[model samples]
Target: METTKRGKVPLYLWMLLGFAAGLGGGLYVNLTGQVVIPEVMEIIRSVGQIFLRLLFMLVLPLLFSALAVGVAEMGDLKSLGRVGYKTLLFTVMVSAIAVGIGLGMVNVFRPGDGVDPLLAQQLLAQGAEGASAIVGSAPQSIEAGQFFLDMIPSNVVTAASENQILPVMVFALIFGIGMVMAKSRATDQLQETLQGVFEVMMKLINLVIKLAPIAIAALMFNLAAVFGWDLLVRLGAYALVAVGAMAIHMFIVYPLLVWIFGGMNPLKFAAGVKEPFVVAFSTASSNATLPIAIKAAEENLKLPKRISRFVLTVGATANQNGTALFEGVTVLFLAQFFGIELSVGQQLIVMLVCILGGIGTAGVPAGSLPVIALILVMVGVPAEGIGLILGVDRFLDMCRTTLNVTGDLVAATVVSRGETDAVVPVDEPLPAVAPPD
Candidate 1:
C-alpha cells in the first residue's frame, strides 16, 4: 500500500520487495548449505513459470496496439522520418556505450575467469543443447550487408504473431509512412481506431502494473525458495561488472546525454522525468510506458502534441540504447566465462549483434534477455551464462527500461526546443496507471 513521490504503490517497489524476499531465501539456503529439496524446487519453478507465461501472454496485444498507436501519432512521414532517425541514432550510440562499458569492465576486471570449472563444463554442455533448440532461428554467419535486407518484414502479420518486435516495428514504420501519404481524413480515421485500441490497451496495462508488486513478490519468493541470491556470488566479478556497468549506463550515461544533447539541466531533467522513469523501470517496457510518456511529454513538458506523439512513439521502438549496451557486454562476458576468445572479427560480430539486438529487443520485462541470449549463442558464446543473469534480470530490466524512456523523453524535449511552437509547462501531472493489458 506504500506510495512513491508521484503517488500510488509504484511498480518497481513491488518488484524490489520481491527481490529482497528472494535474497532472504537465498541467504537462508547458503547459510544452511544443505541440499535443496527437489519437490519444493519444482513447485517454485512451476509457479515462476506460470507467472512468466502470464507476463509473456500479455506482450503481443499490448505491443500491437500501443506501438501501432505510437507510430500513427506521428501524423506524417516527414515528422516520422526525422524523429525515427534521431531516436535510432541516439539509442544506437548509447547502447554502444553500454556494451562497450560492460565489455571493457568485464575484460579489464576478468570477471568470469576461474568460475567453478565444473559449472563451466556443465553450462557449456547445456548451452550447446540450448543452441539446438533454435529451429527457425535467424540467420548467422551472414555478410554484413545482408543483415539490412533481412531486417525488413517479409511478413508483417507473421512478425506480429511471433511477437518479433523489431520486425513489427519495421512494419509499423512502413505502415505509418504509407498512412502519411494518404489523405488527412483517412489518416484521422485510422488514427482514431489506433487511438481507441491504444486507450483500451492502456487501461489493461494499468491493471497489470497494479499487480506488479504481487508478481514481483511471487518471483522473488520463488527465486529465494529455489536458487537463492548467493548464486550471484558464484558469478564473482562478472556479476559485479554486469550490474555496475548497467548502473553507470542508466544513471550516468543517460542523464549526461539528456543534459548535453538537450541543453537541459541534469537534475531538472532527472527530476521532471521521474513519472515516466519509474514506469519504464517498473514495467521494463518502453512500449508499455509509451502512453504515459507521451502524456508526460505533451501535457507536462508542454511539447507540441504532434512532436510528442511523433518522437515518443518512434523512441519506443528505435531508441533502445540500454538493450544495445546490455547485449554488447553480456555477449563478451559470456565468451570470457566459457574461455572462448573473441577475436577482432568476433568483436565486430559482437558489435553488429548488439546493434541489431538493440534494434530488436523489446521493452517488455526480461524481454531483451531472451533476444540477447540468442545473440550470444550466434557469436559462439555459451548461452547458459544467460541463466546466471536471468535471476536478477527482472530487476536489471527495470533499470534498463528507465534508461530507455529517459533517453526518449530527452530526445523529445531537445527536439521540441528547436521548434518555435514547443512549450515547456510548469505543471507536469503525475503519470496515469490504469492497468497492464
Candidate 2:
C-alpha cells in the first residue's frame, strides 16, 4: 500500500542493495570462518522463513479470486475454452523450447566430465543424509489414471486448504462456467464480492512485498554461509552451463516470441516487467510473485484485466519454462557425472518428462528437486546424484525463476493481443455486468 515518491530511492534498487549486502556479508563470514556464523545464519534464516510464509499465505486466496473472476467474466464457456486452448498451447511451445536450449547447452559444455570422483562420492553421501529432508518421505508412486482423476477435486474447500493448485484450478474453472450458465442477481453479487476480495489480497501482497529485500538478503546470506565458496568452485562449471542456458532462453527465445507474437518491442516488454522479475529472482517463487506479475501486466503493460489475470494465475502453476530447462540439463549432467550414457531414445524420454514435470512441479524454491531425482531414477541414473547439483541449485533457482515469471508475462501479452480488444488502463474501473432478470 505504500507508494514510492519521485525523489526517494526505488524498490528494485533496495532489493539490489540487499543482494549485494548479503553476498558481501556471507563471503566475509565464510572466509573468516567466524565462530558466530552459524548463529547469525539461524537468525537470518528465521526471518527469511517468516517472510516466505507471509507471501505464501496470500497465494491461494489470490489465485482463487483472480482465476475464478477472470473465468466468469469471459461471458460464456466457449470464450473461456478458446482462451484456455491458446494459453496451454503457448505454455507448451515455450517450455519445449526452453528444454531444448538446456539440453543443447549441457551437452556442448559437458560440465560433468571432469568432476572429482571423491567429491561426487561425498556429495552422494550428503544427498542420502538429506534426501528425506528435501522431499519429506518419498512420494508413493501413483498411476497415471489416478493422477488425472485426483486433479479433479471432490471437495474444492479441501483442495484450496491443502494448496493443491491444479485441483483448485479445476474447481474454479467449473464454478465459473456454472456462474456463466446460471446468471442471476445472486451470481452478479458473488462476482462483485470475489473481485473485491481479489483486490484486497493484491493489496496485502503489495504490503508483504516490501519485505523482499530484507528476506532476499537473509536467504542469500544463509546460502553463502552454509555452502561457502568451495562448493561453488567445485560446481562452477555446472552452474555456468545452467545459468548460460537460462540466459539464452530469456534473451533470445522470449524476446523473439514477444516481437513476433505480441508485435511489441522486446526491450520495452522487458522494461515493463522489471519489477516482477526482480521480485521473482529474489524470492525464487513464482506463486509468491504472481500478484506482482498481474500488477505489471495490467498497470505497466496495459494488458486487459481478464487476459492478464487468467494467463498469469494459471501460468504460476503450469508454465515453468525455467524449471523444465533446469531439470532437463540436470538429469543429463548427473548421468554424465556418474558415467552413465543415456541413449538418444532415453534422453528423449527425459525431455518429455521434464516438460510434464515442469507443469506438475510447485513454483517454489527447490520445488523441482524431487522431480529431478525421480527422473534420474527413471533413466537409470542414481537418484542420489541430486546432491551433486544441490550446492548450486539455489543460485540457479534465482536465475530460472526470473525466466518463469517473464515467460508468463510474454504468454499473456501474446494471447491478449490475439484474443482481446484494446488494452485497458489500470485506473479505470471494470464495467459492471447486468444481472439476469
Candidate 3:
C-alpha cells in the first residue's frame, strides 16, 4: 500500500478534496454561466496534460519490466508440476470471467452514453491534438487475422515506439518464458535486475501519483466546466456500474468457484478469508496485504503451506482479476463517452489486453492507471477522458483491490483441492528438514 508520505492528510482524502473543489468550481461556471479566463483554463489543462504525459512516459518501461519479472518469478513451471499448471489456468479463466463481467455491464448500462453530443464534441476538441494523433496512428480497421498477426512485433523497439501495447506485452511474456526455461546463475542475475527495474518503476509511479490530487482537480475542472452538471450525473452512473460489476464478481463468481471446485462451503470460505479481505480493503493494495493473505490461507483456511505460498505470492502480481475487470469497463466506458463505437472484434481485443494486463499490472494503489491510459489510446478514445473517472477512483480502487486479494485466496483454495496433502493442521508441527550435510 502507498503510505501518505510527507503529509499528514491521507492521499485519498486529499484526492476527494481536489474532486470536491473542482466539481464546485465547474458547477459554478456551468450554473452561473461565468466565463473562465482563457489563460487560466489553459494553465489548468496544461497541468493535467503534464501529469498525463508523465504516466505515458513510464508505460512501456513499467509494463515491460513488471510483466517480465512477474512471469519469471513463477519459476520453472515443469518443476511446479500440477500446482503450477492449475494456478496458471485458474488465473486466466478467472481473469477472462472478470473482464467479461465488466464489459458486459458497461455494454448493458451504457453509462458513458446519453451525454449531450455537443458536449462530447467539445471534449474531443479540447483534447484534439493528442486524440487526433492516437486515432491517426491506430489502424483504420482492425481485422481479425491482421490483429492476431500484429501481436508478434516484427521489431520490438518499433512496436514500443508506436505504442503497440499488445505486441510489446507479447514480447515481454515470451522473454520472461525464456528466462524461466533457461535457469542459471546468469538468468538468476537477470531476474534480479528485472525485479529491481520493476521496483524502481513502482517507486516512480508512487512519486507521480502524489501529483494526482492536483492533476485530478485540474482535469475535473476542465471537464465539469465544459460538460456542466451533466458530467456529475454521468460520473455517478459510471461509478455505480463499476462497483456493481465488481460486487457481482465478488459475491457471485468467486463464491461459485470456491463452492464447486474447492469443495469448500461458501460460508466457510468467506469466514476464513475475512481477515485478508479486511486488510485488503483497508489498505487497497494486494502487495501490502500479502502476508496477511498467506497467513489466512494457512492458519485460517487450513490450506497447505506450499500451495498457499506459491499461489498467493504469484497471484499478488499475476492474477489480478479485479484490475482486469476495471480496465475493461473503463476502456469501454471511455470509448462510449467519446461516441466511439468499437466493433465486436475491437471489444475482444480489449478483453485480451485486459486479461494480459491483469497479470502484469502492479499490485499497488493506482497501479492500474498506466494500463488504463494506454488501453484508451489503443482503442482511439481520448486518453484525456480518463480525468473524468479520476475523482471516484480511490473508492473504486479500494473495492476492486478487495476483490483482487480475495481472488488470490480463491485461486489458492481451488488449486489445493484434490491434492492428497492439501492441509497441515494448524496445531500440528511440520516435519523438519535436516541441515545441509
Candidate 4:
C-alpha cells in the first residue's frame, strides 16, 4: 500500500530538477570553459556507453527465457495463430499511423529546413556516426529479393541461441504449437520446468534494473556535458514538435485506443504502469522491460496469466508504434534539414519503410538507428544525417522507450479481450486441468 504513494513523484519536482541543472550547468560550461576537457568528456562517455551496452546485453537471455516459457506453457496451437495474427496486423496498421503522424508534424512545423545552412553543414560534419549498427541495416544490404524468406528461420536452436527474435519467434512459435499436440502430460511437465527457470532469471534481471537509475543518471549527465545545453535548442522548434506529437500519441491517442477497444479506464492503466514509465524513461529499452510490463498487466489488471505472458512477449518484438512514430519523424526532419524536397514517391517510401522498420526493430538499445540509416539510403536521404542525430539520440531515447512499452501494454490489454469480451485479447483464459485419473 505504502509503495504506491511513493511512486508519485510530484511533476514539478522533476521539472525543477531538469531546469535548474540544465540552466546552471549550461552557464557554468560556457563561463568556465571546462566543457571541452578531453579526459573528463571521455570518462563521461565511457560510463554511459558501458551502461548502454549492459542494458542491451540483457535482451537475448530475457527473450529466450520469456518467449520459450510463454510459448511452452500455453502449448495452445489455436491461440498461437490467433494471437500472432492479431499482433502482426495491429503492429502494421498502427505503425502506418505513426508514420502519418510524423509526416503531419514535420510538414506543419518544418523543423529541419529552418536551420541555418552553415550550422546544418557543421552538424552533419560533427563527430557524427551512422545511426545503424552492422546487424540492423537489412533494407540496404539485405537485398529486397529475399525479405520474406529470410524471416523464416531454417534452424530453430541456432536462432534462439543467437537471440535472433524474428527467427527465434518463428522457432519457439512452431515448437510450442507442435508440442501442444502432445498429450497433456508431456506439455504440463515441459511447462513446469521452463517456468521455474524463467522465474529465477527474472529475479536476476530485476537486480539489473536496480542498476538502471545509476546508469541513466550517468548517461544523461554525460550527454549534457559534451553536447552542451545549446544542442537541445539547436532546432528547438523541431524538437518540440516531434516531442509534442509523441506526447499526444502516448497520452491521448494510446489511451483512447485502450478505451475504445479494451473498454478499460485509461487513467487506471496509466497509473498502473507508472513504474514502467520511470524505467522506460531512464533505461530506454522496451525489450528490457518486457518482463516488468507483463508482470504489471498480470498483477495490476489481474489479467489471465497466460494472456499477459504470450501477448507481451510477442508485442515486445512485433508491436512498436512509438518506434514507428520516431522513425517517421526523424526521416522527414532530415529531409527538411538538407533542403531535399521529398517527392510523393519519397514520402511514400518513408511511410512504408517506417511501418516495416518499426515492426522489424529488435527489442534492444540503439537497434532502430541502423535500420533508419538503411531507410535514408532507400529514399535518397544522405546517410550522414544519421550521425547528425546521434548526439541527441541518447536523450530522445528515454521518451521513445516510454511510448514503446506503453503501446505494448495497451495492445496486450486490447488483444486479451476477444470480440465477446470487447476485443481486448490481452488476458489469458484460465488453464484447463487434466481429468481425474
In model 4, which regions exceed 4 Å deviation?
A: 1-79, 117-233, 419-437
Ranking by lDDT: 3, 2, 1, 4
Model 1 has how many clashing residue pairs?
A: 15
Q: Residue 395 of model 2: what lDDT?
A: 71
Task: Output the worst ten-in-a-row residue range by lDDT, candidate 3.
Answer: 131-140
Question: lDDT of all the models against the reference?
Answer: 0.60, 0.70, 0.85, 0.60
Quote each prediction's TM-score: 0.60, 0.57, 0.93, 0.57
Q: How far is 145's C-alpha from truth in model 3 (Å)?
A: 1.4
What's model 2's lDDT at 196? 85
Candidate 2 weakest ten by summed lDDT:
131-140
lDDT of model 4 at residue 338?
Answer: 57
Best TM-score among the predictions, by candidate number: 3
TM-score winner between candidates 1 and 3: 3
Error of 4 at 2 (Å): 30
Model 3 off-target regions past 4 Å? 132-136, 420-437
Winning candidate number (lDDT): 3
RMSD (CA, Å), candidate 1 to true, equals: 9.9
lDDT of 3 by residue, 193-294 (tens): 988888888888888988888988888888888788788788889999999999999999999999999999999999999999998898888988999999
* Residue 324 in candidate 3, Cα distance off native in Å: 0.8
Backbone clash total, candidate 2: 0
